[model samples]
Target: MNENLQSSIEFSHESGFDPFMESEFHDSLKKKNPDIVINLISSGLHKSSEKYAEIFADIGSSFINATHTSIAINESFIKTFKDKKLIV
Candidate 1:
C-alpha cells in the first residue's frame, strides 16, 4: 500500500502537482461541524469483495477543504464489472 501510495504521489508530482497531499488525515471535522459527527460511519477495516464497495465514494475531500465546509458533485455509474477482478 505504501509503495502504491508513493507511486501515486510521485506521479502526481510529475504530473505538475506542486506537492501531493497525504492520503489520510486526522482532521477534526467533527468538532468543527458537530452535526456531521453522529453521521460518521466507517466503511470497513479490510475488504475481500468489491461488489458492494464499487458503488460510490466520498472523494470530495481529495480536492476540497473540510475546515469550515465541503462541496462535491456525484458521478454515478449503473454498470457493473464483467471482466477478471470483477465483483458481482
Candidate 2:
C-alpha cells in the first residue's frame, strides 16, 4: 500500500487532483466545513500510508473509515498535525 500511495502521490503531484480519485470523498467535506474526518487507516499502517497520511494532515484533513474500528485516529499522529480533522 505504501508503494501504491507513493505512486499515487507522485501522480497526483504531477497531474493535479484526479476527479475520479477515491478521496473525492472529501467533496462533501468541502461543502459543510467538516471538523472531523473519519477514515480507514489500519489497512494503511505501512510506511507509505503513514507518509500519505502525513501529507493529508498537512492539508488539514484526517482520514477515518470503517477500518478505524477503534473510532479514533492515532493521537500521536494527530497531535503532529493540528489543523487536520478526524471523525469516527
TM-score of each: 0.19, 0.35
Which tens-of-lDDT digit does each residue in 1-88 have in candidate 2?
3684443333344657664464552443343443444444666455545554554554566555445233236676767665444432
| lDDT digits (tens) for residues 1-88 of candidate 1 | 3683344333343546443232322122212222111112233422211211232112211122122221122222112222222222
Name the weakest run of 10 consecutive residues (lDDT summed) in model 1.
30-39
In angstroms, give how far residue 46 of model 1 lies from its true place: 13
- Candidate maximizing TM-score: 2
Q: Which ranges in model 2 have alpha carbons more than 4 Å from their true place?
A: 1-45, 65-73, 81-88
Query: What are the RMSDs of all candidates, in order?
Result: 15.3, 8.4
What TM-score does candidate 1 get on C-alpha atoms? 0.19
TM-score of 2: 0.35
